[model samples]
Target: MGGGQQYPTTCFNTVIKTVVLAGLLAQKPFKHIAGFTNSLLKCYAPDLHTFYSETMDHIHRWNPNLRCNFSATVSVFAAATFNFRPQTITFPHLDFANLAWGWCAITALGDFDPNKGGHLILWDLKLIICFPPGSMILIPSALICHSNTSIGSHEKRFSFTQYTPAGIFQFVDNRFKSEKEVNSTEMSAEERAARVEARKIRWAEGLKMYRKCPSALP
Candidate 1:
């Protein structure tokens, strides 16, 4: 999803988003959630856990107020955004605004036949995953093309999503400067080159964090 896309803002959406965020950030299950998320990272994209943890920690430390504006309370990652989807099939799309190497956490909710409906389609991965209620998946949304198959008309399907945007981290690292502001700054050729080199190194280091592990998900 684009960062600028208008999310549903009705009371129901607000309440559900709040409840899910609260659970992720405060409930006892949060520990399990963190473990499960890390386990998934270890299995599917092992290089990302450190980058994810460090980015989240940085946001929490220096940008504690940076959170989803749509959410009523603090979210799990300070730079993360919250989205709620219910009973609707999402069209195939890349979450381009999210960090390309960072994981997006999605928790499925509501009653539905896993074999028949609410299947997550990872087009790039060539997998159709049966997403049952109360289960979660962590994926690099910006790097994967994904969508969902329709549910039966009588069935219910809901999902809560949490993602951190690359721009947010960039802003934090740039001392809270917006891209435009950063671009407008006058810098010596050496300074600009140094900055670019630093970014390249950071990106490479982030990718190196992933190590191949046995696949855990079917």
Candidate 2:
């Protein structure tokens, strides 16, 4: 709802608007899940969460007319997805359109035994995590290769996810304009060269935002 690859502006999905607007028919089932995931985002990735929240707020402030249900319902996340195909399994892939440093919340639901199936396969990390129903996991969807193992034939599974597109952050950072708009203006030789150098330093600074703790990786 916030932003997507196809369009540079903050917008809504027509299909989702008609279907799974989180707080549409009252906040009963989805609100609690959204709130809990928001808390976990603050707990596990305080700085990242803060950055994303503030940026999303800035986006709203910048685009006062934009109305998105997911961001209004979830607050911190820009978009939400529902994967409910009875036997919900995915092939390994990276969400390349999402923010590289941003975390995506994934919650598995319905009847599935973690021991038998429905395990999160973090291919790049060489780890297979047990994913039980109602389990919420946060991961760098754009940076990591991940998927899930198949559940039993008779078993059923559904998933809800929240995420932000890299274009959203880019939109805010480029002074409320898209990269294409920013690039349209001609840059002087010095300006171009300076920006090239700044990118390297920004990458290093970006790494610092990942807070370190003794309990990390444990």
How do the residues 99-122 of candidate 2 rate in per-residue lDDT, one tens digit apiece?
887888898998978999999999
RMSD of 2: 3.0
**lDDT (tens digit, per residue) of candidate 1 on 1-218:** 12432221112348776687656655555445545655666567655655555655665566455443222223333333333445856899998877767778877777889899888999988999988888888787899999988888888787656666777667666775666677789999999999889988886776765666556445
Clash number for model 2?
0
The stretch of ten residues in a row with the least summed lDDT in candidate 2 is: 1-10
TM-score of each: 0.71, 0.87
Regions of candidate 2 where Cα sits further than 4 Å from its true position: 1-12, 15-19, 22-26, 70-74, 212-218
